[model samples]
Target: MTTAGLSWFTVDAVGAAAPPDTGPLLLDLGDFGSDRTELVGAKAANLARASYAGLPVLPGFVVTTHAAARVRRGEQLPEQALRTRWKQLSGNGTRALIVRSSSVAEDSATSSMAGRFDSVLDVRGWDGFLDAVRQVVGSADAVGSDAPIAVLVQPMSTAQLGGVLFGLDPLTGDRRRLFASVVAGLPEEIVSGAATGTSVVLSRGLGRALETVGPQVPGLTAGLRYRLAALARRTRSVFGSPQDMEWLVDADGVLRLLQSRPVTAAAVPPRHSRPLGTAPIAETFPDALSTLERDLWQRPLDEGIRAALELSGAASRAVLSRPLVHSFGGRLAVDLAAIGAAPGPRRSWLDLIDPRTGLRKLRAAWRIGRLRTAYPMLVEDLVDQVDEQ
Candidate 1:
């Protein structure tokens, strides 16, 4: 995510219901990061990183894991600090609060507890905030782990739009593409899949709506889409990997980050076969492309190549152009245009031998190229034997 200008709008919605400040220190959400996982839990820690990075995270206080343990033990509430914070927020016309679970085991490597945890919204006043905290502690066991669970208390946002953003394409596992499941208003229903949300894809830094799954989301300005994609890319960089982020835009058109986690599943191992549009490689048996397919096969270049077909520009129309060769059952099909192109990172020895051709040697070269394309290892063995002779 570039250092693009992403705005933060504080609306007329709810503010946090902080506990009485009379107790020992409770960490500010901005003070924590990924390193403070043991104290603040995963979500808070990530939010801390976002805040530290100058992201417009909503101001909030963490009811730390230790606080949760203390609360669960039935400690007496000082109650004054809560009133003081509420008074200050209410002074700014922010009256509502959002209480969320920040459990140690919730956003872990093994399990994320997606759609399983609870988030209390529109909580108001100190009593409501305390009740919400009690509720988060109450369901500790079902949320998992013996570790004490923390509750993240923040201002409730009334979103004009909201959605879940994936830093990379999910279906194809393409790192070059980012995808979002977005809704016009709040995303709670859409998140649960109770409603069909708009599907958005951000690829090569450009965003487009793939399809409108259901109801009209309405507020999809181009600027908003760009900001969303840029933010997704940036956070993915910060995490040093792909990220799964829950985000929202308020009625004022400002972006708010709710939560983010490393996309553990996104780190898929590279395929044995290479993808088209990229350069070819030497390995053949499992997932390699041959440098000499054109010679042995004698296939029509314009017909067999996908890239060559595109050379004619708008005039290059095709009935049903197919790839010269398939990779990984057609997932990484060869770009036909590039079949006879120059060598790249994974060059073939056939190219070195192709320029100086003789009749007998041509036949031999063709045979070698053909075999190299078909049985690369066998060709290598043959060449080794001839070199020995």
Candidate 2:
């Protein structure tokens, strides 16, 4: 195993060993030389150490930076090639695989660069398995100029429920509070920022559940929290900021850490003092704007408008001040309006001015003006609201 890019070797043998060959040369975490290859990345190295100490971990292997560099140099070894590598690793068997990006720069002792790489799960067979690994490694190469890709190939363990756990709330970064999100099945969609489903927010009662589950496995809960806190502390130490981690629990209920990184650029800055008075109206408006934008992206205008109105607690049957269209620029204008509305309080007027309601208003005003071509008027009104604020 390699730790922090430092390579070490144990046995001098150079050839592949036969089956049931648990040789001394094959580095486990207990072996220092294995650290040279398997533990090159911080996250992988940490897991190796944890697993070596007899922690519950899914059976897996790591493709070290040395191997990755060899592949990058155009080496034709089938075992080293990602697509064919799995066949050699897994033999001829049908099993689920979890391919993750384990880069030196990611989940480092100091920095936690989150969501800067790729991870693919539930892959089956050698060809598709290799493609997923290649995709992850390639993504790192594309976005991470200086970081070398270290691949962690683990058998996909069963998971009845999986999500993320934070020692502190990600939104507020309050150390006094711990937050957890539990969802059924694998949490791929949620982690990818695609699925917005029911997420349970843990606080007092949930926090107790985290603690109660600890004693069943000695040091399990403590270790998890310790690792999480250590990651956060190290991240802040390295980058002068906090971090967000992605972790999951396997079918056996063993917590297997997947990735860690800094929070997104859009997270609110840490607050040091209490507010003196009510927050500005602009602050509440963003929520409304985000709701509208999300629905618009996920559904048609009519449906999106209805969803937004319902979410904003406004009647969807209210009339609009003007007509609207589905033109490219017009749709873009609505998007901009949604974006603007996201950071502030919802407006009853805006919520009520959906497609159906707007159509009614347009028909009522048909004698006064050409209602079919009045989308610009709605945009103008929204812009005016912002200007007035």
Best by lDDT: 1
The C-alpha RMSD of each candidate to the native structure, in angstroms, is 15.0, 16.0
Off by over 4 Å in 1: 1-25, 32-35, 89-94, 209-216, 266-389
lDDT of 2 by residue, 177-264 (tens): 4555545556575577665434332342224433221113222354444544454444344445444545556666666655444454
Candidate 2 regions with alpha-carbon error over 4 angstroms: 1-39, 52-55, 77-91, 109-111, 197-206, 209-245, 252-255, 259-389
Estimate the overall C-alpha local distance difference test score of candidate 2: 0.50
User: Candidate 1, 115: how far from true, in Å?
Assistant: 2.9
C-alpha lDDT of all candidate models, in order: 0.64, 0.50
Error of 2 at 216 (Å): 25
Number of clashing residue pairs in every model?
A: 11, 28
Best candidate, TM-score: 1
